[model samples]
Target: MPKRYSPQVRAEAVRLALEHVEAHGSAYAAARAIGPMVGVHYETLWMWTKQALSERAWRAQRGQSGVATPPAG
Candidate 1:
């Protein structure tokens, strides 16, 4: 079975991915840099980053409507 990550570990992976994006400006590069911290594979990090960005965009849209719905899986 694959290992499950704790919330703290997920947060750390996200943080590391963001830092890598800031430094390298590419998801592939960011994934390579951030993958080890939480045992996320590079492909998984890419998917997570894409999901995070989409969620952020959705929240911004909902914020304009004054209704902040949680992200859907």
Candidate 2:
């Protein structure tokens, strides 16, 4: 059975993964390095990191164009 994680835990894992990716320039490497420490599968952590980064990029783009982001569901 898959274990459930709290939102705080998920957010922290994403943050760590993103930091690792920024430092290493590779999501795969970031996941491999941080996943075990955080008790998440590398692939799962990578997906979370990717989604967070993508959302940030979208927000930045909208900000540059002076548009507001729709509230996330």
Name the top lDDT candidate.
2
Q: Can you write out model 2's per-residue Cα lDDT over 5-66, one digit (the tens) per residue? A: 88998999988888789787788789889989999988888877777877888888888998
Look at candidate 1 and give me any clashing residue pairs.
none
Model 1: per-residue lDDT, tens digit, 1-73?
A: 9767787877778778977787878877898878976688877787778788778789898979888777778
Residue 30's lDDT in candidate 1? 92
TM-score of every model? 0.69, 0.82
Give the number of the best model, judged by TM-score: 2
For model 1, what is the error of residue 69's alpha carbon versus the real structure, in angstroms, after optimal superposition? 8.1
CA shift of 34, model 1, Å: 1.2
RMSD of 1: 2.6
